[model samples]
Target chain A: MNFKEALESGKFTVTAEVGPPKGTDITEMLHHIDLLKGKIDAANVTDNQSAVMRINSLSVCKIAMDKGLEPILQMTCRDRNRIGLQSDLLGASILGVHNVLCMTGDHTSAGDHKEAKTVYDIESVQLLNVVNNLNSGKDMMGNELKGPTSFYQGAVVTPEANPVEPQLMKFEKKVNAGANFFQTQAIYDIDKFKGFMDFARKFDVKVLAGFVVLKSAGMANFLNKFVPGITVPQELIDELKEAGKEKALDAGMNICARQIKQLKDEKICDGVHIMAIGMEDKVPEIMERAGLL
Target chain B: MIITKKKDPNNILETVKKYDKFFLIGCSECASLCGTGNEEALQEMTDFLESNGKKVTGQLVPKTGCQTLGTKIELKKDKEACADADAVIVMSCGAGTQSATEIFKDKPVYPSNDSLFLGNMTRFQMFDERCSLCGECVIGKTAGICPLTNCPKGLLVGPCGGMSDGKCEVSPDVPCAWVRIYERQKSLDNLDEMKEVLEPKDWSAGQKPGNLSTRSEKKEEKK
Candidate 1:
């Protein structure tokens, strides 16, 4: 389905994400998917979350699909050159994984292999254009492909981005380059999210405000400090801080539900990506409180 | 502001499948300026290589590659350009060819383009690599202001508020970057100019040690 139709399904399309383990273990990963299968519309398999190499995102995504779930394949351009990138795009298509998100992978410095060489012949915007080209039966050099790709191309956004104009400019560029839909960084501040939506609405594209489930205020602070372009406000940190050890989990879920409700009630975005991280079980509860159930 | 361009060696020493007698040739013009194939450089390199054992030959060809074709630019093709030198290490930029390969395409070719984006030459032999284009440009939020450009003295952190009487606190000659930014922003019709504060940039990626460029939200790792 075109991303727009899937996004504006109006029933408030709920999606969840699962980051695979850095090691070769699938039991927890499978459990995560099994828990979210019928609870949400689709599950996204993150590619090497934060660029530290993990179990292949595509392989894990295929596993999720095998469990009778629609997996939004997240492909980053970090580890692949142009040849590998296109091959992977075709690889995803051949695997029947039609919903794919394109991203320029995390920097090598942030990953496990700090000294690894980076083959940067293609980055994200170019990656989006590359997929657009592939779908048009052409490669980066404008060479024709064997067949066209009908993959539903998606990109990302950071609502709380610093100097947000560049993000907006990139958002526009991605759309022009054929990004049909976008998933944003988690939203903790309503004003910031609204501002982002205001910017997004100006462009003709589908947006899913991404929700990264915070385990605690510490996690929020970590992202704000270390993670570039992602800032969870102090109020959310305070809310997390108020939750006692035993009840912290409960408070986190409550916060997630509250945010989800606001996102749905305000129609802040076309959809929301529930990134439960390792805690996939709480997703359904968050959804239930948000009234998606 | 390190402005320079690649100077591909003319006789690239391209694909020296096999070799022995090697002349470390040098170009006196662009290569010299770029600190690569100059006579002093080639001489030093040739001396070091000779000290290591192999028979050596060296020549300093000036204006060797001002044109695209032929040896017309060849000021003088001594024996070093022909016989003694097994392969021509055409120290000129990619434009430098034939002189080395004329006698030896069968030899190798190497590049000296050190290709770099052209930049304004600030001084006689020095240049400032202008417009770093940090991805996180505070230009918009800062009222069409560029803390980078306006500050003649190169300060990423905003100018000191205590700039003694409008001049840069850093120096007397340098105008406060903030003062310039304020003026530019005011003209841009953004009254909100100077209202928004600039965030200290994420020096992690932009830091030379990281070697990361200002990319979109998606940071590309060099594969």
Candidate 2:
């Protein structure tokens, strides 16, 4: 089933993220897609993820479609103005890529191109509204669309954000703006996630917990220190440390699979979205370990 | 007030290399407070120019450099010096530079300072941007904290996923605008307003080349 159908069917859906290469060599990307063809409900093609320029997400989405792997076209408001954003959405719709994950992307200064001019004309909530407007057979300005889109719109939330109220408020705004589902930032602490889920259960939308696989103890420490809205508990770090450098990757996979299993078994949310970063080859193994396959 | 920073002296020198003699203009308001257009700065620039083999014809610290007509009247005394100068260097914001440009139609006009943004001086010489002039104001709904200006992404609804420890991801030192708004609204017992999804901003309202007149409507009506 498609992502929307899968969500509506109340199945424990699984999705993954695939970052398009910086250069034109799509060899690794295609291989990743091939590895995840049937494993994920939909693969999200990142739009210049972390503000670093990459192959456009739309082209990769089309490639994923051609490869028979469903693609979620991740759209960020950082790089495009409303005009460009709306035009791209229409183009994506016509190109047969429906699912969109709207996000207010990382600031340009955070990326390799610090000198790049940012165009956050509209943010994530507004972008979700734009998608809703397109799906309703009209553009943002209330102009009629010649051919309307039918997109399964998604948005993101940071469940473990320190100041959770504001994030929650934005979450409700996204839902009100017609976000069908939400794939969150990397989630490590399940108990903390449970609290967020309790509040999210009131809404009609679906929530998919996010997991970014930890490669080592140092990686976990780095995430805890630098990355916002993500916290890797001390115990997980200890487990990786105990696993040592060579086996840390396997230990990280075990941690991710265990979290997924806990989230699924407890019905914390509808699904899970795994961001393997560059470890796409290990996703199927992680899934198999989680009893998803 | 409009915040500004002085351009590099070498870059400024390179820009006016063709001109040997130049007149200087500074603002007594925001630019002066920013130390980019004060009397000391003008004297410093004059000395730097003279040392670099360029002549300083004259200098003026206008009460308000952007008050183009007033500045024009004030420059009447310096007409001889201005006419003698090969160019005029404005040591103020872009608006002040344009004022000099208007007065010196034939002479080459250049800005010595880059106009940064409209901001308030939080401390002595410390400024923070408080408004983006988005035309439409949503601070009433946001408990007077302007997210459109403070938030790096200008997120209207609330903070983005990048907000952590009540700080914005753009910079750890910068507090998340929406968090401040949320807290303020909560303190006021007006958190219900936070739930209202703001409609998309009409960007055309703040479109470029914005022009406005606050003159009394009765004069136009009488005409």
Candidate 3:
């Protein structure tokens, strides 16, 4: 079943994201896709993830589709203006692509390309509206189209964003902008997530708790120190530290599995979006350990 | 105010080399403070041009360069000298340069300064960009700070994941704008106000060649 159908089925769905390689070499990426076939409801192909230059997300998604995997086209406003975004949406539809995750991507300065010009011609909320407009057979300028799209619109939210009110406000705006589902930023503190869910449940949208698989104590510490809207609790870091260098990856997977199990067991959200970063191969193990597979 | 910086003297000199006589206009407002089109700057240009074998017919620093009608009225006193000049050199921002262009359609207009942005003079001659003229304002929500101008990313809901040690990823010297806003909001105990993600700005409002009338002039208009 497609991601939209899977979301509506009320059964907890699993989605995984993949970052396209920087150069033309797709051997590793295609292998990753083969590994994830039938393992996830949908695979999100990231567009220039972290503002770093990579293979286009659309190209990667098409590759995934050719290999018989449902692809979620991650579209960001950082690199494209309205014209580019609308054209890609039309192209995605024509190619039989289904899901599209709209987001205001990481700034160019954050990535390897510090001198790149970032175009936020529209933010994530407005991008969602643009998708909705395209789906309705009209463009942002109210121009009609020869054929319309049926993209499953998705947006990202940060539950742990300090001054959570703005995040909540943007969440409401995204929902109002025709976002069908939300895949949030990496969430570690479950109770805080539950609090965010309490407010999120009021809207009629699917909420996917975002899990950034922890690889080691140092990684967790890095995220805690550097990444915003992500608070890796001390105990989880301590757990990874106790596991030490030899078994840290296993320990990290176990920690991710435990969070997934708890989120699933408690029915805290509609589903979980596993962002394994470069470690996409470990996602299935995380699922299996979580008793999901 | 609209900040401006003087163009390279050599470049301006090269443009006016074909013309023997030139008139100069400057603004006493933003241009004066920026040391671009002030009375002192105009006099310096006059001396420099005179030494370089060019006759400066007349020079005047108008009350406001962008107020086209007012500058025209003030320039009437220098009408004979202006009429003798082959070209008019404006020593203010782009807007003020364009004002001169509008006033003297018959003569070629040259700008001596490049307009930068709407800014505040933070200290003596030091300026800080405070707005992008995005046409829509959201400083009310961001503790009177403009993320569009201050944040390198222009992120409305930011302090993106790249922030480190309360500094922007782009430069360590530049403190993250969102971090400043958060700290300001926290100190003012107004953090709750920033919770709503500012909706995307109505970019059309900021479209190029923006024009609007506030209706405050309605009383005069009806007269």
Candidate 4:
């Protein structure tokens, strides 16, 4: 079944993130897609993840579709103006890629090309409205479209953001803007996530808890120090440190699988979105350990 | 007020290398307060120019450099010196620089300062932007805090995912605009307004080369 159908079925829907390569060589990316076949309800093609330039998400989404995998076309407002964004949405619709995840992307300064000009002509909430307009056979300006797109719209949230109230307000705005589902920033603390879910349950949209598989103790420390809105609990870091270098990867997978299991068992959220970063090959193993396979 | 910063001295010298004589103009308003275009700044530029083997014909720090016609009239006393100069250097904002361009149509006009933004002076010579002139104001709904001018991402509804510890991810020193708005609204017991999803901003209202004429409005009123 497609991602929309999977979500509506009330089953635990799983999605994985796949970043396009910087160059044209899609050999490893295709291999990763092949590995994830039938393993996930959908594969999210990141649009220049972290503002670093990469192969466009649209082409990769089309490629994923050709390989019989549902693709979630991630669109960001950092690089494209409103005109470019709307045109790309139309292009994605024509290519049979329906799922679009709206994001107010990481600023261009965070990327490799720090000198690049940013174009935040429209932000995530407005982008969601644009998607809803397109789905309704109209444009953002209220102009009619000859053909309409039926998009499965998605957006992102930060459950662990320090100032959680503003984030919650934006989350509700996204819901009002017609966001069907939300895949949040990587969440490490389950109890804190439970608190966020208690508030999120008021909305009709589905919430997909984000999980980034921890690779090592140092990685957890780095996440805590550098990555915003994500705080790695000290105990989890200690668990990884005790596992040592050789067994850390396994220990990390175990932690991720355990978290996923708890999230599923407690029904804290509708589903989980796994962001393996560069470790796509290990996703099936992680899912198997979580009893998802 | 419009905030401005001076161009590098070396870069300015290089730009005017081909010209032997220059007539400098300064603004006594914002540019003077910014230390980019004032009597002291103009004297410093004159010294720098003469030491670099260039000649300064004349200089003026007008009451308002952007008042094109008034500046043109004020510059009439230096017409001889201006006519002898090869180029005109403006040490003010872009508007002030364009005034020189209009007055000296035959000579090349150069700006020695870059107009940064419309902002307020938080302290002596320290400026912070507070408005973007988006042509539509939503500060009433946001508790008088303008997110469009403050937020780096200009997120309409609320903060983006990058807000951490009430600070913006882009710059840790800068507090998140939405967080400030939320706090202010909460204090005023107007948090309910925060829940209202603001419609998409009409960008056309702030479209490029924005033009207006108060005289036309007055004519319409008279009619």
Expressed as tens digits, the lDDT of each residue in B53-117 for candidate 4 is 99999999998999999999999999999999999999999999998999999999999999999
lDDT of 1 by residue, A64-172 (tens): 8889878888987667777888888888888888888887655565668877775444555667778888888987678888988888888887666544543454566
Candidate 4 chain B: 10-residue stretch with minimal lDDT: B209-218
Model 3 alpha-carbon drift over 4 Å, by segment: A112-117, A141-144, B6-25, B40-60, B67-90, B99-112, B120-207, B210-223
Order of models, best TM-score first: 2, 4, 3, 1
Residue-wise lDDT of candidate 1 within B1-223, one digit each (tens)? 2233433332233344255567555566656666665676677656654665545564655554534343434524564444666665555555454344553446564444453533456666565444555545666655555655554323333332223334543345655556566556557766354543333344344555333456765555443
lDDT for each residue of candidate 3 in A1-293, tens digit (9 for 90 to 100): 77899899887889998789989888899888988888888899999888889999998899899998899999998898889999999999989897999988888877898888789877777788888889999998889999888889998888887656545666887898899999989999999899999999999999999999888899999988778778999999999899989899899899889999999999999999999988989888899999999
**lDDT-best of 2 and 3:** 2
Clashing pairs in 4: none
Per-residue error (Å), model 1, residue B94: 6.0
Tell me the deviation in Å of residue A43 in model 4: 0.8
Give model 3's docking category: acceptable
If you superpose only chain B onto the true chain B, what TM-score does each candidate give?
0.44, 0.96, 0.94, 0.95
- Candidate 2, A225-257: lDDT as tens digits: 899989999999999999999999999999999
- Residues A1-293, candidate 4, lDDT per residue (tens digit)? 78999998888989998889999899999999999989989999999999999999999999999998899999999999988999999999999999999999999879999899888888998899999999999998889999999999999999999878888888988999999999999999999999999999999999999999999999999999889899999999999999999999999999999999999998899899999999999999999999999
Native contact recovery (fnat) for each candidate is: 0.00, 0.87, 0.24, 0.82
